[model samples]
Target: MSLTRRKFLSWLGAATVSTTLGQAAQAASNKHFSGYPQSHGVLFDNTRCIGCRKCEEGCNQVNELPGPDRPFNDLAVLDKPRRTTAKAYTVVNRYENDGMLQGPVFRKIQCNHCLEPACASACFVRAFTKTATGAVIYDPSVCVGCRYCMIACPFEIPAYEYDQALVPRIMKCTLCYPRIVKGLLPGCVEACPTEALTFGRRRDLLRTARERISQFPERYIDHIYGENEMGGTSWLYLSGVPYREVGMREDLGITPAPQLTAGALSAVPMVVGLWPVLLTGVYAITQRKEKIVKAEQEQAVAAAREQARAEAQAQLAQALAKAAQEKEAAIAREVKKALEEAAKVPTEQAAAAPPADTAQTPTEEES
Candidate 1:
C-alpha cells in the first residue's frame, strides 16, 4: 500500500498519544507514590478556630495578594461560604451545627496537597509537581493553560486567573513551601491566635490528631478527614461535627487518583493501534479494487481494438474479391465483342461476292 504523507502523520499522532497514555497508566499503577518521607504537613482543628479571619489577612500579606472588598476584621464574610480563588488561597467558611451547643463550625478551605495529586497526574506537560516538602506546586512556565487540573482535583482547590487575559495561571495554596523550608511557620498557621492550625511532620500531626480524638472522644469525631482519603493528604483535619457538615467530602475512597483513571486510559493503546491498521487495510482494499477496475478497462479496450482490426481486414478482403470479379467480367465481355465483330466481317464479305461467285467463280476457282 502507498503511504501518503497525511496518512503517516495521522498514524504517528495517534500512536504517540496512545502509547503515552498507556505507558503513563501502566507506570502509575506499578509505582506507589505516598509522597516523600518525613514531609511536613498541617493539621486543622475545627474546635479551636474562632472565625477571626486573621489567617486570611496573614495569607494575603505573605502572598502579596490584592485586598478584599471586605476587610479581614469583618466576620460577616464567613456567613457566605467561599472556596479558594486566585485572590484568596484559603477561606474560612461557617457552617451551622444543628442541635449542638457548639454553635457554628468554621472550616478553613485550601488545597489538601494529596500524596498522589491528581493535578500532577493529569498534567501531561509536567507543570505540576509534588515536591519532597509535601507541597503540590505548579510551574507556570510549562503550563499549557489546560484547566485539566481543575477537573482532576477532588478538593476543587485549583483556580484559574481568568482576569489575567494576557497570561492566565492556575492558583492554589502552595502549603507555604517557601516559608516552611526556611524554618518558618506558614503565615496562616503563624497568625492563628487559637493555635488551631498546627504545622509539623505528617506522621506527627497524624499522631496528634489521633491523641486528640482518643483523649476527648466526645469532643471530636473518631475519623481524620485526610488520613486515607484519596490515598492520604499532607493536610489533615479534625472536626467536632460531621465532616459533611463543613463541605468536606467523605466519599473519596482510599484509591489514588492516578489508579482511578488508569483503567480507562490503559485501553487507549490497543484501540488506537488497531484503528490505523484497519484504515490501512481498508485503503489497500480500495487500491486493489481500483487496480482490478483498471485491468478490466484495459482488457475491454484491447478486445474492442482487436475486433475493429478484424472487421477492417474482412472489409478489405471483400473489396479486393469484388474488384477481381468485376475485372474478369469486363475481360470476358471484350472477348465476346471481338469474336462477334470478326464473324460479322466474314459473312459480309461472302454476301458481297455471292451472285458472281455462284456463276462465274465455278469456272475461275475450278481452273
Candidate 2:
C-alpha cells in the first residue's frame, strides 16, 4: 500500500510528538539526585554524652590535624563554646539549659553531611564530594577560594583558612570516610566510650534513633535532629532539651539549601547568555534609528539649500532683466538726443548759408 505524502508527514509528526512527550515525562519523573543508598552514618545521643573531648582528640589523631593550643586532656577547653575550624574538624560544646532537669548538656558539632550536600552543589569547580560512605569531603586542589560552599551550607560547617597566604582551602568534617571504607568506625565514634556516637547504616540509624526516642520519652526530645532537617543528614542528633536551646537551628525546613538557589542559578545561564545578544540588538536598532533620522535631516537640509539657491537664482535673473531694460531705455534716449542734435545742426547750417534764389541771382549778375 502506497501512503500519501501528507499522511506520511502526519505520521512522522505524531511520532516526533510522542518521542518529545516521552522525554519530557522521563525528565520530570527522574528529578535529579538520589542520595547514596545504604550509606554509613552516625547518631549522636546527647543524653549519654559526658562532655569529654575524646572525639576531638581522636579526629586530630586520625586526620593528622595540627596540635591544638590547649592539650586534649585539658578539660578546661570546654569552658568556652567553640565552633569547628581548620585545625579542629569537630568540637564538643556545653550548653546550660536552665529549664531542663539536666544542668548542662554537651552537643558535638561537625559537618552534617546533608543528603543534597550544599557544599557539593554550591561548588562550580567540583571541589566537594559526597561519597557513598556518607562523607562530604573537600578537595583543596580544585578549590579557587570562592567561599560559596561556606555560604551555601545551612549549618555553616565549612571554614576558610584566612591566615594562609596562598593555597587556602575550605575545611570541614570528612565523616571518617577513609576508615569507613576500611570497615572501621569514624574517629569520634570509635573514641566515644559511652556509646553516645553510634556508627551504622543511615537507614538503621534512623530506626535506632526512633527506638531511643520511643524507649525514653521523658529523657529525649520528640523529634530527632537531622532526621528530616535540610532534607535529612547522615549525622543524626538526639537532644534532652529543645534543639534551639543548645544553639542548633530547628527552623531550617526539610528543603535542602541547594534547592533554594537551584531555580535562580538555572535562570542565570539564560540571563547571562542572552545579555550580549540583547544589548547588540538594542545598539543596532538605535544605530538604525539614528541613521534614518540623519538621512531625513540631510534630505530636509538639502531641500532647504536647493530652495534657497533657486530663490537666489530667480532674484539674480530679475535683477539682470531690470538692468538690461534700464540700459536699453538709456540707449534709446541717447539715440533720440543725437538725432535731434544732428537735425538742429543741419538746420543751422542751412540758415547760415545763402538762399537758393539769392545765390542764383548773384551768379546771373556776375555772368
Query: What is the alpha-carbon lDDT for the whole of candidate 2?
Result: 0.84
| Residue 337 shift from truth in candidate 1, angstroms | 36
Candidate No. with top TM-score:
2
Please, what are the lDDT tens digits per residue for candidate 2 over residues 34-124? Answer: 4588887899999899988999999999999999989988988888989999899999998887875556899899998888787887788
Identify the runs in model 1 with alpha carbons over 4 angstroms from their true place: 1-23, 26-31, 285-367
Weakest ten-residue segment in model 1 by summed lDDT: 21-30
Best by lDDT: 1
Q: What are the Cα lDDT values of the candidates? A: 0.88, 0.84
lDDT of 2 at 345: 94
lDDT of 1 by residue, 138-176 (tens): 999988788999999999999999988879999988888
TM-score of model 1 relative to the true fold? 0.73
> Residue 53 in model 1: shift from native, Å?
1.1
